[model samples]
Target: MVKRALISVSDKTGIVDFAKELQGMGVEIISTGGTYKTLNDAGIKVINISDITGFPECLDGRVKTLHPKVHGGLLAMRSNPDHMKQIAELGIEPIDMVIINLYPFKQTILKENVELHDAIENIDIGGPTMLRAAAKNYQDVSVIVDPSDYIKVIEELKSSKDVSLKTKFKLAYKVFEHTCHYDTLIAKYLREKIGEDNFPETMTLTFEKVQDMRYGENPHQKAVFYKEVGANKGCITSAKQLHGKELSYNNINDANGALELLKEFSEPTVVAVKHANPCGVASSDDIYDAYVKAYEADPVSIFGGIIAANREIDIKTAEEINKIFVEIIIAPSFTDEAMAVLSKKKNIRIMQLENIGAPVPEGSYDMKKVAGGLLVQNVNRECVNKEEIKFVTEKRPDEKQIEELLFAMKVVKHTKSNGIVVAKGKQTLGVGPGQTNRIMAAKIAIEYGGERTKGAVLASDAFFPFPDCVEAAAAAGIKAIIQPGGSMNDQASIDECNKHGIAMIFTGMRHFKH
Candidate 1:
């Protein structure tokens, strides 16, 4: 039976009624500061914690409920004869229940211009201490941290005059989980304030499961999607699915790839991804024109793929996209007519990413799981402009060729390793990703591009090992090329470009998406 309960909560919702129910059952209530006032105003009999401790609340209300009287009451195990004797000699009354919620540390710090001292002051001390003590001695004491659990707890107590040990254990575990998550957020916030923003020695991450996927990449594997805790702003993970069926594992993966590549461009752009690889990408003044160019890049590879556009979707773009058997389409917005037309296809998933135009915030990390461990690194968001490029060939590329060359490089960075991209003007002619050899990448891109390869600019994620890629580009009528200059045979590749009279530029930054 819960004879005495302690209530000190920052969130006062439903506390008065809960205390009334406890008082009706002949349970004594001891509260602190705001909680006491709220309960007293509601005409509920609540003993002030300071009155019970026989000491006044000091230190701007920070040191309340830390007295020996309170802790001794919560920690004295009733089952142990010696423990009961010690508590009786010490004049400590056993506290059977603890009701508390920590101070609003997250809320206070999240406000604009919140000072460090203010955030520090908001971190509850006595609350967590009392909670931990009560949870540890749950065999004798019942702990309540969440107000939502009040109704069920009250019903259980009314039904049996005591809660079962199973229920007590579950509530005890909840306190540890709650405190662990609270401490992690506080640690992460303080670490960012200092200079240890990158990675901490004892780092903590939190995630909330979004949904269970139909399966993994294959039919036999199980899969679930988890969204980063408090992640509600950018990226596909935060996107709202506007229409269609539930997202499969492959669909979400490819959609994320398409969205990342789509963010690389500020202009009206469209990117088509297949098997987590970009098969088509293009940018233009008109979104419809961009979609047309991207789809034409590799029509065969784009079939049953994911399409992500940087700009709003119009009726024309939707009509053209509807011609293909695409699995997903994600963009900023869509016209009523476009949605009406596309809604006919029941299986095509459509997502609206509101922050598609906004840049990704700083301190974002890319992570992957490995055997018995995980790999974490900063996202590869750097892109070189015209000033960062070095003209490597004797024949320099013209301004138009330079513009197209940069566009191709943006698409290449999003592709898998050993990737090659051929682009003309603002449109991608062909994309070759995940090849065993660089030369094979070039040949695949050229073959897929067909006649469109003529007068197009080519971009490679990394430097060419030999002149074979250059030779293949020359045969395909690729007028200019852009690649990182890091290979020992870089001079050989440069010499090959000179021999073919092809213009080449080096970015120095290599984007290897393995």
Candidate 2:
């Protein structure tokens, strides 16, 4: 018996050539709508789905592939005697292969001024149904969901007369993944339209496998990268590694964190990230000065950390970067001469993430994973101004201290929970992040700052729960403090600062980074 293959696609690229290859292998080609037209126009033997079902597409083409004949051919198990008998009795031909691609719902909605009706219309129903049915019978039928798989399928057919079971299983998995992602995009859009935060009780997330790393964070664990389904503008995952070694799990994590921190600054900036925390960061008139000040902020921690710059890397900056044993370097662009110099370090992963500084849309949520659940909250993108700050102390912070306070606030916004940043002038003197208590974070910052903490201003991402943090800051010779004054013990903290003769200001905005 001749094997039957079904081909239904919205994207018709290389469809004719693929169908011809299947025809040469004695496989009957069945297609619908534009696929059938394209195959026939190319002088390839094709059987339209309407001819097999004896029914023209109805309901404005939405009811085309919902017929039993198409589904039965796709879902039947060839090894089951009862199924084979039923197929024969019902005149249902076995579909040996299924090639399908869904409509571009994401692209449709991405267009400027797109209407809701057009977006809803682009949501594919029959395509996913066909793919799922075909995938479910992977043991008997081969499923191809991507156009890139066509050539491989043709090659396998020409060589062995049939695709392998492993290849079929992989393709089946891909089909399910593709359909799941398509449905997710549609569902997310619909949910957003209705203004509902509660999603379906059963949640499904789909991400495409981007790469398989050599190992995970350590040598023992295994890991791979999966890009979330959508157009990710300015995402580190979408960046191109122009040169250097393959990125490790830690490298990608640090690089992503560095990029996120750098994205907040419009000016030329450099951020040094270590263990997913910003060890040092500075914005300067030039990229070289930015790198110099950022590196000088904490030379010890900057030794093996990731460095991200918003400006193009030049020879002067590259020379300064080469002095350290940096793990990863990311920038918008790099001069050819700079690349040549940096290439000497084979272990350094260099990435060119052009336009990575694009402003992100407001009201985005940040997610963190715990043992059994996740915590989600809105991102801290609030703008701060000096006039909005309330100086609650007699000794108010000077103008220079206000500038440092704002800069420290920006740095603290990117740190983990219980973050405290101390800065004097425009340089980050010390950063104590990811502590269990604010006082402990303050102590760490003071210890790290050493002599530099004498005249520096402290910026707390959140409000002080008690006056203990303020006492710690005063003991470290900190002259001023900036925080979101919302604590019930705010008066106690204010009294402690007044007794210590330290200046304190409230910005009325919290900057929790965790």
In order of appearance, the predictions have TM-scores of 0.92, 0.88
- Once model 2 is optimally superposed onto the true structure by TM-score, how far is the C-alpha of residue 321 displaced, in angstroms? 2.1
Q: List the global CA lDDT of all models.
A: 0.89, 0.86
TM-score of 1: 0.92
lDDT of 1 by residue, 1-514 (tens): 9899999898888888899999999999999999899999999998998888899999898788898899999998999999899989988899999999999987887687889999898888888899999999999999999899898889999999987899889999989988887787787677667764478765677665799988999999999998764434657787899899999998988898888888889889999999999998888899999999899888999999999998889889899999989999999899999999998999899899988866555666788889987789888888775567899899999889888988999999999989999899788888889998999888888888899888999999999989999999999999999999889999999999999999999999999998
Query: Model 1, which residues run further than 4 Å from truth?
Result: 12-17, 195-197, 212-214, 229-232
Candidate 2 root-mean-square deviation in Å: 3.2
Tens digit of lDDT per residue, candidate 2, span 371-481?
988766555556466567898887888888787788888888888979999887577889999999998898888888898889888989899999999898988899889
lDDT of 2: 0.86
Residue 412 alpha-carbon offset, candidate 1, angstroms = 1.1
Candidate 1 lDDT at 470 equals 95
Q: Give the TM-score of candidate 2.
A: 0.88
